[model samples]
Target: MQLTVAPIPFFWSKDTWSAFYEEIAETSVDRVVLGELVCSKRLPFFQDQIPGAIERLIAAGKDVALTSLALITLKRERKLTADLVEMGLEVEINDLSVLSYLPKGTNFSVGPLVNVYNEGTLRWLASLGATRICLPPELPLASVEILAKEAEALGVTIEVWGHGRLPLAISGRCYHARLHGRTKDNCQFACEDDPDGLDVATLDGQPFLTMNGVQTLSDSYATTVHQIDQLRAAGVTALRLSPQSQGFADLCHQYRALVEGQCSSEAVLNAITGQTPEIRFSDGFLTGDRGVAMSTPPIAART
Candidate 1:
C-alpha cells in the first residue's frame, strides 16, 4: 500500500512548518498533501513558503497535492478556495463548497473531512472527476470494503485514515481563541503554542477531545497497523498519515516498514510510544464501536 502524508492540521510557525515538509521529503512516503487545512488567517505567515516546499518535495520524488480549508464561511475563504486551482496541483477538497469553485471536469481528490458515507456519494464524486478519496476515519471495515469495491468499478483510488488524531469536527469559531478569552478575529494566533493540539479533559479528569484552532479531535491517535491487512484485502490502495510535530519522519518510516511486513504492529506501536510515551491509541472506529475505544490492550503501555 502507498503511504500519503496529509496536510498539517495545526498552526505551526513558518520555520517549523517548512522544516516538517523538508523532513517529509526524505522519507518513504509516496505522496504529500500540503497547504493550510485550518483557519485562513494563519495562511499569510507561510503562503510564500508553499511553492518552495512543493518544489523540494517534487525534487525528492514525492507526488504532491494542495488541500482546501476544512471549513469555508467568509468571502475571503471562498476566494482562497478559488485560488487553489491556480496552483496547478491536485486540490484535495475537504469542504464541499470547494466544488462551486472548480470548473466542470476538473480532477481533484476528496479529503476525509467530507462525508462520503455511501456508494451513492462515492459514485457522485467520481462523476464529478474526483480521482482519489480518503474515506472518513469513522467508517467501519464493512463500509470501507463496500466503498472500495464501488471505487474500483469507477476507477477512483480509495484511501483510509491511517494515522493521527481523529479530526472529529471543524467550526467557524476558533476554540483556541475562545479558550484565551478573545474573539476569533482579534485572537493573536493562540493555537501556535500547541503544535499538535491542546488536549481537553472531562470534568472528572478523564482524557477527552482535543482542540486545535476550530477543530475538535479525538483524544487517541488512531492507528491502522492492526487493520492494514484487512484494508488491503478490501482494495484500499493508500494510507493517509497526518503530520504530527514530533518524530513524524520516523513515524512515516515505521508505517512503511509495517506496510511492507518488515515489522509487527506491536513494534510500530512501541516506536510510537517511544517518541511520545503519554500518547493513547485507538482503532475502534474501524470496528464500529465508540470511536475512543481501543480494540486491543496497549502493546506498549504509557509511563
Candidate 2:
C-alpha cells in the first residue's frame, strides 16, 4: 500500500511547518496532502509557505494535493475554497462546501472527515469526479471492504486512515482557546503549546480524547499494521498517516516495512513503543466494538 502523509492538524510556527514539509519531501512516502484542514484562521500563518512546499514535493516526485478546511462557515472561507482550484493541484475536500466551488469536470479527492458511509453516497461522489477517497477512520472492516470493491468498479481509488489519532469531530468552538479561558474570536493561538494535541482525560483520569483547536481526536493512536493484509485484500490503494511531533519519518519507514513484509506488526509496535511509550494504540475501528478498542489480538498479546 502507498503511504500518504496527511496535513499537520495542530498549529505550528511558519518555520517549523516549512521544515516539516522539507523533511517530508525527502521521505519515501508516495503522496502528500498539504494546506490547512482545521481552523481557517491558521491558514494565513503559513500560507506563503504552501506554494514552495508543493513545488519542492512535486520536484521530488511526490504527488501533492491541497486540503480544504474541515469546517467552512464564513464568507472569507468560501472565497478561499474558490481560489484553491486555481492553484493547479488536486484538492482534497474535507468539507462539502468546497463541492459548490469546484469547477465542473474537475476531479478531486475526498478526505476522511467527509461522511461517506454507504454505497449510494460513494457512487454519487464517484459520478461527481471524485478520483480518490480516504474513508472515515470510524468505518469497520466490512464497510471498508464493501466500499473498496464498489470504488474499484467505479474507477476510484480507495484509501484508509492507516495511522495517527482518529479525528472524531470538528466544532465551531476552539477547545484550545476554551482551555485558556478565552472565546474563539479573541483568544491567542493556544494550540501551539501542544504540537500533537492537548490530552483530555475523562473524569476518572482515563485518557479519552485530544483537543486540537476545533478538532477532537482519539487519545489513542489508530494504527493498521496488523490489518495490512486485510486492507490489501480489500483493495485499499493507500494508507494515510497523520503527522506527529516526533519520529514521524521513522513511523513512515516502519509502515513501509510492514507493507513490504520486511517486518512483523509486533516488531513495529515494539519500535513505536520505544519512541512513544505513553501513547495508547488502537485498531478497533477495523475489527472491534468501538474506535477506541485495540483489537489485533496477536499484536496486543505481544505488547
RMSD of each: 2.6, 1.6
List residue ranges in candidate 2 displaced over 4 A: 297-303
| Model 2 Cα lDDT, one tens digit per residue, 61-171 | 999999999999999888899899778889999998889988999999999999999899999999999999999998999999999999999999999999998999999
TM-score of 1: 0.97
lDDT of each residue in 1-303, candidate 1, tens digit only: 999999999998999989998899999999999998988999999999999999999999999999999999999998988899777899999999999999998999999999999999999999999999999998999999999999999999999999999999998899999999998998899999998899999999898899998999988999988888889999999999998898899999999998998888888999999999988998889974778877753344212
TM-score of each: 0.97, 0.97
Tell me the number of clashing residue pairs for each predicted model.
0, 0
The residue ranges of model 1 lying beyond 4 angstroms of the native Cα positions read: 297-303
> In candidate 1, residue 273 scores what lDDT?
98
lDDT values for all models: 0.92, 0.92
Candidate 2: residue 153 lDDT (0-100): 98
Q: List the lowest-lDDT window of 10 residues for candidate 2.
A: 294-303
Instruction: Kindly provide the TM-score of model 2 when superposed on the true structure, using C-alpha atoms.
Output: 0.97
